[model samples]
Target chain A: MTLERAVAPAQRAVDILGGDVSESALKGYLEGLPGVDAVGLEQRAAGLGTRSIKTSSKAWALDRIIELIDLTTLEGADTPGKVRSLVAKALVPDASDLTTPRVAAVCVYGDMVPHAVEALGAAHGDPDQGLVSVAAVATAFPSGRASRAVKLADTRDAVAAGADEIDMVIDRGAFLSGRWGQVFDEIVAVKDACRKADGGYAHLKVILETGELNTYDNVRRASVLAILAGGDFIKTSTGKVSPAATLPVTLLMLETVRDWHRWTGEKIGVKPAGGIRTSKDAIKYLVTVAETLGEEWLVPHLFRYGASSLLNDVLLQRQKLTTGRYSGPSYVTID
Target chain B: MTRLTVPKTYKLYLGGKFPRSESGRTYEVATPAGEFLANASLASRKDARDAVVAARGATGGWAGATAYNRGQVLYRVAEVLEGRHAQFVDEIVAQEGVSRAAATAQVDEAIDRWVWYAGWCDKYAQVAGNANPVAGPYFNISAPEPTGVVAVIAPQDSSLLGLVSAVAPALVTGNTVVVVASERFPLSAISLGEVLATSDVPGGVVNVLTGSPAEIAPWLASHQDVDALDLVGAGELDWPALEQAAAESVTRVSWPEQGPDAATPSIERIRAFTETKTVWHTKSLL
Candidate 1:
């Protein structure tokens, strides 16, 4: 177990950014990423949403949506019982149907990681084993308002507790104030903190909290900056913000990821977590993903939904497709 | 110059707001003589489901209100119905193709019957519930509670009066209703929705869907969230099948076995949508 094998990916990030890594250089590069045509980008995303994916395609999309969900419960009232039930749901989303696909991960607060991990049990380790992975939101989530030491410690403790992925929030204060190097350094530091004792690194998802980032241009720049800092995923919001995950913002992030893949041949994940509640809305996101990044990004590793209630809606739709009857809230679990 | 007519676009009244059918389907409404009138929204099964959702949302506010407060709201509905008297008469005339006198009689009876039922909102609980003398050393009492969201298939033949008679009694008991209006004569029902909207009855407490009950009733009957199915207006359809569907979900079925109800409203209609709970209390407090 050597640090060099683990630090290879970290070294590549520095090489890709050309080794200068100064505040002004990062600012110059981020400021130079083309300005977004807000109206056109929104119109394109809207146009893509109108493409109907129905019947067998819709049925397939529902199962894929289930697999892509990071079934989340980040409420202040979240308890161990709630996290356990959330994981239970992630394992067999619809208890009525054993064939229902398990969700990609169960996302919770960092402190709740061990509980989710313990609840997952033998089904915890590998997606290939039809298991649900545990994802924890770290670095003073929702609001990234803590010191770098505390944020790193938060990341390390959750990784130590068996969290497969860490969802970290970037410092919007630094990013909005044009402190690109600080934002870049923090993500890189958090990514470094994700290293486990066995020389493995937990997946690092950087939440932009796009609702706080006023313009699409800023979202685009933050997205590219996070990728340059070696984020495995660039998440749209913390779900605590209004306008958490809109189609247009996710579309822009997907485009950034697409371009990054074209230039550097690396595919970064995109997660739109908050307001998407229905199967129809989730299908539209799938359509956007396929059209923007080719079907390659549709997998759980490259795309995910940071959601809780969205899972129930997908289950209801799945039940409708299977039974040819409509379902209600009574049909699904309360969590 | 003669004034041009501006026809009203009839939409489904769901959650107190008027929205077009989810399917965007509308059917032509004509006098029984085959003359054309306005087009009314043809509510689909999904519309019935949406109405059920709306009714479920309003159940808390309507059922939790004090009996006296519910009485006040029902009285307010009667007040609004009275203000819209001429409109109802015209709608009934157009819908049933009956003479003004006949339509007026029906409208008057509907208004009067509604008021009569409204008066019972606070009293039916007392009439349907009572204290019992038991052998144990305890005070035993029984009281009726609303059975939650009720889906009504309003009687198709007696347009205005039947609709009022069927819906008012359920409202009297503080059970929110999602009613499918008389299919052939739905203009008055949609107009009644306007009256309920302004009467403080709350939006979802009385959702009105204007469409074929045959298509909509089955969905409502089978819906798991719907507590009871009132097939009072569903006698014309394959009501036996609706009852079967309701039976599958164990929903309380309200089928008027004797056919068309009596001329006046009955307290039994209110009791049908209530569950009586009996509780025993110790004789002394510690």
Candidate 2:
């Protein structure tokens, strides 16, 4: 093989990688590139086959889809059976061959917080280890249609039951009606209630229910409104809307959180919920947070996917990579 | 004569009450002089949310106010800050750990930056914006509107100047801001916050939080409520990643060129805070 032939393959490889180059064309292009060195061309061909830019793009898209499961699973409507199944799987030990993205939290109804706590407790102590410790539909959650007093009490109850975090929904009805003050006051009361419990308190994640909010512009405004309303984290969708946790919505929230952190010297968290169900989907969100907020929020503390059942796929992928052998679904432990 | 000694602690500037960090978490503030000035709040993520609620509760009339009223309110802030010029000098000096003279210069620039932004409240739309020439004849013009809530990372070195420069533009354009001044110089930012509160600029419009940038910025960056982000003071950020995360919602990001002096600021900085929209409504013959 000649040097000119060797160089030709790399040239063809670059062309095939550009845009919509078909697979066969890419193969043909790789074969023809005049890379004079046979071993080098073969190595290059393998590298191109496995390490394409599209692979990273695909990984990112996968991450976002994985994130949707949590975004779409509304706690108020979740059955006890569903919660138990999630808890059992989350508590699975990491030492096993089963690979799982630690369930960030098992969001449940306020009435269900104790059940989740008990289930998580039975699995193990160290609240965050075996479980993420979540209480959803917080003070006026699902609907901010309650009195401030009632909502505050709701928050208090959830936190007292060992909920490490509270996912509270804002009154989008009031917000859309331009009653910003009412919406603001409701969030404040809930935040105060969270603090009164346990000396300081559980993380308060404000669910904007963006689908109801309407408009990207409104979503942006609501995001700012929720954060300023004392939300420790701002999440999209209660998983009950027609359009729950879109990529654009999560991205906007991430940007808002980033800007807020810079100006105030305070850290906030972001969770994208609804419809996520693949390893590929989870990675997109990881990439989104990684790109938007830096590497700091890559962990469960600041970044989480409100998911269910997506772990199996994530595990399967991790397993495949480690052993270089595809395994049966049962071989990977989801629970 | 005993030498005057400086105190070494920062209290939470909440509702005019200067309380110790409620979380009891404290971190050191390093000055340009290569010394630790004081131990300030390592505000937890919870504290940040608390501040947001405060800001949100206060945004009703703050953002809904008539432009004229809003301008007047902002102008009053500049006046109040002017009246307390000496206090700012003292705070900036201690926070930045600079000589009184240099601190005075920085303070003057910071104060002036507010005045500059204050003036923009009444006229920014006319300058950076205009009526668009449309092909189909209908009154068509695009103007800039506030993007609602904004989060800022004030500059690290110029403390007061950088903080003022980043903050003023955001608020002046009617966007409520949650600012994180340099952890190295919270006193000045807090002092500025005090002046704004007294100036009647509204409570949550400009909530100030202080802690570690590395810890807090990612949270803010990824936060869902924040509409836009200003990185003027973000020294070395991973732009690609930051933009990627922001791309999810296409959050507006401002990466303006760094101003000359650490403390000297500019009007161009406000460009990061505004957006232009041209709405077209067409009526067809029945």
State candidate 2's DockQ: 0.01
How do the residues B1-286 of candidate 2 rate in per-residue lDDT, one tens digit apiece?
Answer: 9989978466555443455555689888766666766777777655555554455555565657766777788778878878998887877776666789997887777767777777777787788777666777465767777776676777866667788877888876678777777767777777777787687776678877777665666656555456787766776556555555555445677763365654244556666667787776554545
Candidate 2, residues A210-305: lDDT per residue as tens digits? 889766556666666666556777888777676777666777778778876786656777888776666655665666677678976765556667
Best by lDDT: 1
Model 2 regions more than 4 Å off:
A1-335, B1-9, B13-22, B30-36, B56-60, B135-137, B237-240, B256-259, B262-267, B280-286
Determine the TM-score of chain B of model 1: 0.96
Give the Å error, residue A242, model 1. Answer: 1.1
How large a fraction of the reference contact set does each model reproduce? 0.44, 0.00
Query: Which parts of model 1 have CA positions greater than 4 angstroms off?
Result: A1-13, B134-139, B256-264, B280-283
lDDT of 1 by residue, A83-188 (tens): 8888888888888899999998999999999999899998896553567788999999989899999999999999999998889999999999988888888988
Q: What are the per-model numbers of colliding residue pairs?
A: 2, 68
The 0-to-1 C-alpha lDDT of every candidate, in the order given, reads 0.87, 0.64
Q: TM-score per model for chain B alone?
A: 0.96, 0.84
| TM-score of each model, in listed order | 0.95, 0.45
